[model samples]
Target chain A: MSQLNAAARAPLDSRAKMIEFHEVHKYYGDYHALRGISATIREGEFFSLLGPSGCGKTTLLRTIAGFEDISSGAVLIDGKDMSDVAPNKRPTNMVFQSYAIFPHLTVGENVGFGLRRDPRSKAEKAKAVEEALEMVGLKGYGARAAHALSGGQRQRVALARALILKPKVLLLDEPLSALDKKIREQMQVELIKLQREVGITFVLVTHDQEEALVMSDRIAVMFEGEIAQLADPETLYRRPNSRRVADFIGVMNFLPAQILGEAAGHVQLEVGGLGRFEVTEEQASARASGAEPVVGFRPETLTILYEGQQAHDREAPATIDEVVYYGDMTYYDVKLDGVDAPVRISMRNVFGRPVLDVGTRTRVAWSAGALVLFR
Target chain B: MKFSSLKGYAFLYLVFLYAPIVLLPVFAFNSGTIIAFPLKGFTLDWFRDLFANQTLGLALKNSLIIAVSTSILSTTLGVFAARASTRFKFPGKTGVMGLIMLPLVLPEIIIASSLLVVLLAVGMPLSLFTVILGHTLMATPYAIAVLNAAFSSLDRSLEEAAYDLGETKWSTFRLIILPLVTPGIISSALMSFTISLDEFIVAFSLAGKETTLPIYIFSQLRFPKQIPMIMALGTCLVVASIVLLATAEYFRRRGLAKTGAKDTGGFL
Candidate 1:
């Protein structure tokens, strides 16, 4: 399906969209961990809090979980004030980063553990446990001890335990972090599948941008203690609203950008070092961005030449600084003098031919449409 | 496994500490009631006489009640202390923790006398109630020590996960936290019980009309003929101490094993 069609048909189900934090501040006695966080989480949507470590992403998640109360401002969940709601009383469940499976309990016990007073009949509880285990692909493993499971197995167990409770929303705090790379990829796919099947709101906190992009329906890019941008992963990656968001999500070449002209349709930007680039509203509304913009172009969109003079308007002459071969594509870190940072261009081997070498002077070329100018 | 020779050091360690406890039952059966090396005919007279002595039995009953009360109360306090110290960041946290642990280093005599003076000044009479209060205060730090091991080493993410799973703070602690830290709680309770049982200075100073076993043993030291009976009682106490200490150690070791922590340093 086309991106437009998918977005046009996107449904915001009864996702606990009831989360709101109004001017909330958290202080660890002078060290302001969360300066002033104001955010609303829509229920049923898979929203990911993405940032580097110590960006207060986990703190945000904990605050939502009621583990850490906001020092100031009121937080509401499901339209009820959550300033005094304890973690246990909240209608949310979390899959922790370490996959905090109860070490002393077996898989079955861990899954049904939260349902202490859940008046589910024995058969119903067993059925739920079995279905949850099966959903995570650990059907028969319910009898296995939590300690005996491998990291991935343990992660699945943690997921099943939380999922079985079927809370209004599920909070995943880097739940797949403990698994090996291969298993992490596999589990990421499984997690996305499970999130869809369960149809519960999921708020995932992760420092890993790749993982966030891979799993989240919408991503909230956090910096320090505030959300820099909240948009779909593609929007977040393609045209990050801020220079900080652009630098965070993926590799981008930032050149000093100025508005040459702004009309009702498109905005003309004079990007220093890389020359002029035009951005249209059909790409992403520039008004939501800024007036004076910082022009950025994704590395993968740029084509690096071995040796050539570009005759096109969207060409930047630069010397190939570094070359990184990543199996499917080769990344050329091109350095154009007078630019603030090195211009990165990733070229895939379409016809089994290699591109520019390191230290080799080359011209990087891309479409005027490919370059994104953000204010 | 390569530290096989460390087993020898362990053996020596046990013998050095418990050789006396091993001799208690041996001397308990001595017909002479005297604990000398020369072979004495085996007799159950000391134990029979101990049962027959109404005051001694009363002392035994009093000590049991005090220790049990101290264990239950101190361990309860320890649960809160352990949870607070592990889970939250409070003001003056370190200083407060140091103060709690101060009793561990302070001499028992000082604690006893100071407590005695304070209680008297407040018009509280010396009795089993006062003894329980003092013993609980003294045993609390050890309870904290044991429970802290369990609480600190616990997987905190588990608790976070519980909260995310729609569990209230109280429910999570009741259903999940307590179960995970059960071994530590048990170990703490046992350690407190034995510490109170074997404690003397505070109990002696506080026992007005009520004498605990340790105070009774101390009083019997005044008479010459009572020496043998003291040994018999000493023998019994040695056995009790070893049992209590061993059980506490067992639970502690089990708690550590549950958390997958290395046995770096432990109670002998």
Candidate 2:
């Protein structure tokens, strides 16, 4: 939870900036890969470009690594324009999605490859390579053939190889997508600790939203070569500026609502099945494109109040339609007495709490503060 | 084992393929000059005669020069062609590569005659150098085919990774690309060498006054007494070809194993 709080903190403008994209536009023939992107990543921040495939997340990361040339606009690294910099001369390294370990070299040789141009003595360079390997938890693995390592070991080798150079920024392109679920989760925590220890700006490109939420200090959610929403993990999930951003980051239940009236910072809406409620300006976000007005609530925000239990803010009678049992939680789809469709509600399965059966009558408790009006 | 007819057909097919090759060594050691089924007493007289013949010696020298030059020239050109075809997109790519590989399926005599006509029309003298040029044009396709497999299987990210780690484009190629595809280069060179050494139509048509081994062997066929000597030369060629091709195949497999790529059947 503390880690989550750290990830949810915003980077202030007072901090030094590491990378800045000024109206970056990239075109591959007729296809526009990145369209007029302008954003600044602060120094020592764990930033993420989160999106689905073909959303230009990886393409944006490549621009930072100098692997891709922007058709128009400038890319500035530490206040220096990089329009003419070749990838080799740029002060950045990337961990490829495939963990591109050189098959012909030993692990030690691969990690020391970037040191070929370093003016340091051979002994000093070797020591630095060993230190890098030890940092990645692959100590004493230098003599092993690179191709013979397991997939997780190969990923560590890739990390060590890139970090030994101590570049100004480290770019990771889906580095953990190739690992199994358990290892993927473990690596996510390890990567955060490593970033903190190294104090280098990390730019990660990932399609997994939860991974972004768990690791990034600030996340830029992209769609169709445009940033749909850029905010901290908490703000992006709780106060998404558009309906599309809400749907992409997490699950949200939506019901048809009629806009009763609107004021400067308050919106009065009569929501279907759940009755009427007044939402503030911060809660009434605009809908992307022209869609019907609706009020949305997260599954966990609506609780099934047991018999004789008092409502927290508002109460509605409903019958259980379906129940899904997870190990630590239970999800129930309940149809309110006047509602036409069933709405889902998740509850923590505490010890001795009854798991309600289908068709059971129950009272749902909800609050106006949890509602988001998408109009 | 139950399909007796199929088994017999396979046996017949093998004999049809290797029967002529088996006769080369048989006649090479025979002392008889006349072509007959019964073998004469064993003797190395024809082999001795083959060593002493001045014209055969000259033909051997010309063949070596042509084979070495053709292999080097074609493989170098093939490396460039293969790298371009795999790594970049250009207009008319397929058309250009198709034209380069056209000679592989084209009849050898047609290519030889057309090349001779064009060279003479341009007032270029035909010599061992002309033979070398003809052989190189024909052998380039095989070299490209082998090298293309090598380059296409290589991961593009490997080069990018090297560049990201501060190596220049040329050093990236020399350090990573070259070593990864070395086996392929070796295989391509051997293939070009083998093809140019045994080629007959191009050498026969384009060679002027300088006889390659194949041309010399054809001219000797008119004398009945020289048949055994020619058989000795054929036996030697077969052995050399087998050794060369086997080496090429070994290197090809080593390349696949090193890259951890699957073996799609090759020239062997």
lDDT per residue, candidate 1, A195-305, as tens digits?
Answer: 767878788998888888888878888888877888888888887777678777878776667778878888877766666666786553432244555667788777775
Could you tell me how far off, in angstroms, the CA of residue A67 lies in candidate 2 after the best superposition? 1.8
Q: Which candidate comes out best when scored by DockQ? A: 2
* Docking quality class, candidate 1: acceptable
Candidate 2 achieves a global lDDT of 0.90
lDDT of 2 by residue, B1-268 (tens): 4879889999999999999999999999998997678998899998999999999999999999999999999999999999999999999999999999999999999999999999999999999999999999999999999999889988899999999999999999999999988877887898899899889999999998889998999899999989999999889889988887887788778766765667777768
Judged by DockQ cut-offs, the docking class of candidate 2 is: medium
Candidate 1 runs further than 4 Å off: A1-43, A68-90, A256-294, A306-317, A336-341, B1-55, B88-100, B163-168, B222-225, B246-268
Q: Alpha carbon lDDT of residue A296, candidate 1?
A: 72
**TM-score for each predicted model, relative to the true structure:** 0.83, 0.95
Error of 2 at B244 (Å): 2.0
How well does chain A score by TM in each candidate? 0.86, 0.96
lDDT of 2 by residue, A129-223 (tens): 89999999999999888888988899999999999999889999999999999999888988998888888889999999999999998899999
For model 1, what is the alpha-carbon lDDT of residue B16? 94
C-alpha lDDT (0 to 100) for residue A124 of candidate 1: 89
